[model samples]
Target chain A: MKNIYSTLPVIGILLLTLVSSALPANKPPEKGGVLPVINLPIPKNPTEKVYLGLSGDGFFKIPQIKAKVVIIEIYSMYCPYCQKDAPGVNELYTFIEKNPDLKNKIKLIGIGAGNTPFEVEVYKKTYQVPFPLFPDKDFTIHKACAEVRTPYFIVVKINDDGTHQIVHAQLGDYPGADPFLELVLKASGLK
Target chain B: MQKIRLANLIMVAGMLSVFVTVSMAFAISDAYKGNIYQVGTIKPVDSKLVVKKGNQAPDFSLPSVSGDKVTLSQFRGKKNVALSFVPAAWTPICSDQWPGYNIIKDTFDQNDTILLGITVDNIPTLFAWINQMGKLWFPVLSDFWPHGAVAKKYGVLRSNGVSERALFVIDKKGAIRYIDVHDINKRPPLEDLVGALEKLGK
Candidate 1:
């Protein structure tokens, strides 16, 4: 079994190379091969001390702002989805604020990237964001969180029975938050 | 000989069918035409700003990257507004997206439209980046105050505090005549924008 496991991948690669060579020189296989772009190794999970930068207001951190559930909003100023989502985001803020217990358990943070500091400052002023929005100028936070782009979110929670397990991680465009929020609520044991 | 010829024909036909299927899958036909959607139904937003077709455009007093106040009414006189909502600057998508506006700078001018890219990013940041990227033609507006307020009005702000990649073609009358929302992964084809611009005429 061990020998088979070791040989399988190599055998598969050989088969792939053979099949590719058999095809007409002008026409390569339609799928399956190494991509052209430079690939970099990324860690699946972030280590401690690798924190998201300060929100534009200079407040909040990854671990410092402790909560049962942490809702991190990753966005850029000009994205239409981000713009369209602004009101929804405001509502999310309002919803959490209205629920003290949920608010205590759930912490909302916004991280703005890909824009200039001045741009971020303007965004901060215009939105009147109740929560802090961290600026990921260097993309260190983005890499640590494994975010591909803005208008997505990362929801994390400490499990109910303790042990502080990193229960859920979700990322998608705006409308994807409902499911993420549900997972967070479950992780926090909020029915 | 006949048997070999028959086999070859079948193999070629099979390959052709597979090629056609894949091409159709990747084709950029009106993939979004029948799939159009209102921004509201997709997410939650503030009720104050409703940007829709034929609706009198909401007015906003915001600053440009140059630190000048930009008002909706300013473009009401003659120039139509091509408000391209970008996700963020400096990222791969935004880098490609903003430069797209620059490449088509003359298109907006040819159509007598004022193209403005608006975002929550601030002026100094925008100024420096624009200088570096050299997109002097498309003024990136800052909806930084009241934060995402303009985007909220348009129902395009994502839940994450950034605006989605939404394009709005506002006519001289200040009505949102055309709205195209592309999948975040793709940019709306230039042909679509040009086609919409043609409709802006009589």
Candidate 2:
């Protein structure tokens, strides 16, 4: 009984130290709450709330990109990771083509948000992207989306009432179109 | 006899406590996440001269995919090594870019350069993926175990867990002569790499 009573303080001190050390000492910044958002205003492009722009071909309305679901692909032309993942992007484009329903539900747009507009244009031309790519030169669009990294993927879902919601956001690349397709199908209510 | 038994128990308990403390120290070191920079002055490893100019050179011993054994260092001195670093292998950009290195294996050989890729990924995952991708020519080095120790030593490992995609033209003396660190999203120009090699050869 004496030993147990004497050991209680040590045990309590150990537990307290462990618990205090385990907790984060500092809190991370809150999204949009701080003045950091003041750096760039959300893109009021009008067609797409944050991501949409005038179609390079001048055929479709900014938000009316041909699919029930839209993918806003954020990338810089010079990022090796982005270049390495270029084949997967091509594969995704092919994957969408193979699934008519999935294709109808999905629209992938390449956004050059990282590099200069000239560099982005050269990259798009070199890669021969099938979808329209817009250069977010000043990062207004990026600021609007609150994007933090290159090669980010944002899945935009169009509601029946013509409003949009960010259904999914991914920072890094994952292979195959299955994961992306599933998200699109789920968001768009496509069978 | 009772005193002897108690002495043995105390020694055993002391040994066990020491072992626990050592293991905990190791765990704390391993639990280190985020980037930790090398504590010394940044070393400049660019523009030096050495041997093995334009010839298939001899190989050396380095860590293998499992990192358990050293297998693929033989290509080191023989060919010009395109020391490529990617953020992580599984991500989209790394996935596409590593295979692109494979696509240019013939070109690398034409210049007598063996393209060596490095990342902080553990040997196990790297072994499986390299085998899956069938990247036969390039031997990917695992900067794991020591936890990107090589990258940290080289001053390329970012404050993040991964190292930046930096290209180093390591000469035959194993001294890096040309160093280029690109933006995370940018791929180093292959032409610039070739030019660096040509200049080194000259």
Candidate 3:
């Protein structure tokens, strides 16, 4: 009876451990992968156009960002996960803006996976997202990235020759703005 | 022996407490992942729609997820209504469809339209399902109890006790302006819905 009582507690503890350590559905990806230059539309907003160091209209590419490092966030208006992470993403943008050195070196942009132009506008207005957001109404960006799930993050380092390398690619939410910013900076060798 | 029994009971209780806490944490933060069911492709659409365009929308008095009784007549003269009849809750296409409307509150308002999402699922099921979706501006009405009574009235109740993926746009004067019994496997394009609303204005 004594051994059974002792063993029951051990078994209970194991069950508790199992429940607590349930496997995550999608883990934040580790860093590495060089990507082709991604084409992007010129922001209609005049302020956004100037921030990205672009002129005229139509389309531009990721390497065109004057910053040394660029952070691209792939989100969807329909995704609850993206909605949950919006505030953190906005804070991350703000954190970069407040820092003089980081602000000039890092830039952030977002792509609305499978979202129309109108839908992307609604999301931006709803969340008050400060960064330049583009619509992928045709799922072009989504398919290019192997249909990455919403709320995915990718940090890229812009090269001298206009090509960029993917330093980090996380499939789900990050730790937080500060921690994730540190991760991005470290991954880009900026820290 | 009684003391040993007591010890075992205490251990089980402790473990349950830990388990419950972890589950609650996950539900609060990442509820979307665990709640969704991935049902693979079925028939594109299973039911034949009974109501056609220009039919006075069969009036329904279904219970909304907000604990209020919603009637189609309520919006008759005051506001136009768009009835979205989705098949079921927690399914693949059904899950994201409503949340996709979450950002377009303005578009509906501009057209003086009130969207009511109808499903055969009960209120409790809907509450649990929508908790992860944040706050939806429109009321999600349940067509359960008589089990898809409202859906059946509109002729969308499927053979499998669900509804067809359908949309009905009714004008403010209570005339059914458009009906699109969309393919169940795919989402009806937003442009089609928006165009219908825009036409209503003209």
Candidate 4:
């Protein structure tokens, strides 16, 4: 009994530390909120336009994503963490794309916060990102999203009314694909 | 027995806290997000522009984060050099600017040019802060010991100890080809720098 009591406090502290490190201390006020409907110009790339199911050239909003859940990666070509996180994000997209059950249900998109179309194209060409990425040259979307830090992840649940309910928001990058997918599944309640 | 248990618990708590604090400080991706001190807005340009397009770039040797003295004149006749001077280490715009250069290493390589990143902070400070960007392709030099001597030569040293967010493109002949004394408040568009580098060949 005495030994167990001593071990319990140690375990508790370990748990506390793990929990604190997992979530960024300065996470933006993104969770439990409705992501504003920001419009993006239709992509010029035919494949990208088809991938996002975009039609008619003017603009499109996040609610138009035909999926049960959408994972919006708010990133910047200039952000170091975003550059670091690129490969892992591409891996996540592959995992979802290859998996039949979750393929169409979960969609991945990246927003280049404060990035011009030229900058976005450079990032796409550099990272070989498979998904559609939109540019926010004037930071219109970034300001709408509370100017969140780069490499920020927002998991939004698509409701019947087409509103995006942000279920989870994480600052910094997530390590590894499997564990991060588990997190996305859990956050979006897909599992 | 109870007193010993209390002591043990206290000891464990202390160790855990230290471990956690150290972990946060040194973690690869988390370090940058943890220490971002926001400065809303400041002076656009606090120093005069002295180096003109055709002038010879003032040369200097400064210690880099990589533990070597980088001399501008060393690259003369060998490679074109783009001297990137940021205000200070760990500040808002300065922190992310160099990291942005990481993705565009090809542009510099293709242009047969090398970038030398200079900041007013000392090596120790620059090391910890630059680590936030992972390993940069270029050398990051410290202009700290002589207090922005290199920056002062280029007329980029601010009224304060910090350097101006400026970039100098010196051709193979050591003739300064381009000079951008950008607004201190924002990142100078990467296109602007790349455009300058592309212009060197012409």
Candidate 5:
């Protein structure tokens, strides 16, 4: 009886170890956490520089747009969810472009986690993505952004002082481009 | 004596429990192996080159995504072949390479070349992955049964149970014209493949 009692603890510990190790490592960042400042290269144009930071809960600084609301997509070319969401992302880009007021005020870019320059190009060309898509080949940008899941979208509000803050963050695809644009506008305090 | 025998029985039971738990852990990892994404920059591999240009390409029949066996020899006299050996399916680099090739179907068609994508993953895994990219223009062959037999034959199989990210261009005469065993973690430039095809002169 004493032997069974001693062995029971050992078995229990083994089970616990197995359960803990099997769990997934990546999880979405908290909704209200500060968006880290990280240097990200421009996907379409590598010569330019871009920085992600926080404003008074708004404004992100990207190339071409000094102060604008930004929608940052943390994606991977190998992610099937990202692949499924490609057409919708393109639609979102189109919606932003067609709007006269929102076009210049907002920018969309994708940071492909662990994707090489060539891999990022393949994604953009294959999906006909018009927005700037950068490669985070080393996961440096990805880790700085809190290691969010693929197809993760973060809306940032760029402040007048050139700082930016994340207004909203979400995982998975939005219902459609219209709803997504509305969310971006609302998050940016424009709506 | 009875107490000692019971102690031994408990010890045996405890060891068995540990073994079972460890086995379960391994099984879980294997099942979700496709979901594990490796991050950061991977250094280029200095592969031990085995196959050289102008050698007759080794022939083999493997199961493809189309539910039919694909024999490399079948296309010997009919078309030039580009054998794309990716490390595995669902990883960062391998996933994008094939889709990138998908857009350049015209390039392959123009060169009279048939692109064959080979990976060490099985059919179901390949099917589930390729389905997400929509319809692929070329056939994706699995070297899973013999666990990368074809990749081994070509000398591109890595020690880690996967193939290196390699590209072999075979002329219609079944002679290897070009061989590019790229860095396992990097994507070979699309232009390089196209340039090689252009050099093939048809």
Candidate 6:
């Protein structure tokens, strides 16, 4: 009887360990939160001057767009899902570009999580990605964005003070270009 | 005593139920969802330089993903070879490394070089992972069976039964021109590979 009692607890502990080990290690960021400030190299032009608060860092400044809405894609060149969704993302870029009003008020960019400058260039060339894409080689930008999975999307509303608020944050690929553009347009109050 | 034995059996049965539940939960978890496993922060690997530059490259043949065997000497005297040894398939870093190479075929073509991607994973695993990313322009070779035999010869095999993320550039003369055993957790700069290939031209 005593042996059984002791063994029961051991089994319970083993079960707990196994269950916890299967849980996801990374969690996606919450929606409707302020965008994290991440310093990245300016796409295709790292040496360009950009201001961050009082500092004169040459790195790409986040949420620095002049538009009212900015969409940022956190992706990696190695991510298969991101590779598959590349065309859809391109379509979304085209949708925005063709709309004269949205084109002036909205901007999009891709941050290649863990991708080097060369790697980002290859991805751009392969997909013929029109929007500016920057390499977050060290994952500094990825970590700042809460280490979200590839193809994660963040639609932000740029505030008057240059700060931005995340209006919508999605962990996976958007359903399609139409709905994706709708979500961005609605979230940014353009619709 | 009979009653006590029955009670002990009940206890054992209860324990088995818990074990079964745990196993079932794990079986249905996200770990098996595609190849996206949760890997922690990047761990740096300090690799030893085993092969010297300007030395004759060792020759070996391995099965490729396309169902044909590939031999290193087959490319000798005709094309320059770049051997890329990644740690394992399905992991975060290794998964992205090759896909990035997929788009840089032009860089290799510009220098008249061919890339041979090698991993210790079996053919099926490599095939599934590579296919997930779309068709690759270069041949992907499997170093299984002998279990990282090629990586072992190059001294890039990690102690954990995987290869270190390494790149070796061999000239058309079958001589090792540049060797980079990069940090296992990070991607090697593309320009570095391009620069090495250009040096072989000169």
TM per prediction: 0.42, 0.42, 0.76, 0.83, 0.69, 0.76
**lDDT for position A3 in model 5:** 72
Model 6 residue runs over 4 Å out of place are A1-27, A40-63, A159-163, B1-34, B38-49
Task: Please give me the total number of clashing residue pairs in predicted model 3.
Answer: 0
**What lDDT tens digits, residue by residue, belong to model 3 across residues B71-125?**
9999988999999999888876677778878778888999999999999999999
lDDT of 4 at B5: 67
The residue-by-residue lDDT of candidate 3 on A1-191, one tens digit each, is 56767777677667656643432223333356665335788887998987787889888888788889989888877787787788899999999999998988999999887678877887888899999999877655554565556677889898888877889888776688999999988999999
lDDT of 1 by residue, B70-138 (tens): 888888968898888876554345443564355455667778898888877677766755654443666
In terms of lDDT, which candidate is stronger, 4 or 5? 4
2 or 6, greater by DockQ: 6
**What is model 6's C-alpha RMSD?**
10.5
Candidate models: Cα lDDT each:
0.56, 0.54, 0.79, 0.80, 0.72, 0.75
Q: What is the descending lDDT order?
A: 4, 3, 6, 5, 1, 2
Binned by DockQ into CAPRI classes (incorrect, acceptable, medium, high), candidate 2 is: incorrect
lDDT digits (tens) for residues B1-202 of candidate 6: 6655555566566665544432221111111245566454444564455678888888999999999999999998999999999888877667667776777788899899999999999999998888777789999999997998888888887777788899999999999999988877566877898899988889
Stretches of candidate 3 off by over 4 Å are A1-30, A36-38, A42-46, A54-61, A161-163, A174-176, B1-31
Model 2 / residue B180 / CA error / Å: 3.6
Interface RMSD of 1: 13.5
Q: TM-score: which is higher, 1 or 3?
A: 3
Name the regions of candidate 4 deviating beyond 4 angstroms.
A1-29, B1-31
Query: Residue-wise lDDT of candidate 5 within B1-202, one digit each (tens)?
Result: 6655655665566565544432211000111234656643443553466789999999999999999999999997899999999987767667666766776787798899999999999999999878766789899999998998998888888777888889999999999999999977567767788788878875
Q: Model 5's DockQ?
A: 0.14
Better of 3 and 4 by TM-score: 4
Best model number under lDDT: 4
Across residues A50-131, which tens digit of lDDT does each residue of candidate 1 receive?
2222223323334444466666666665444454466667667667768777766676767664444544454556566666
Q: Write the per-residue lDDT of candidate 6 for residues A81-105, one digit (tens) a residue.
A: 7777889999998998798888767
- Cα deviation in Å at residue B56, candidate 3? 0.5
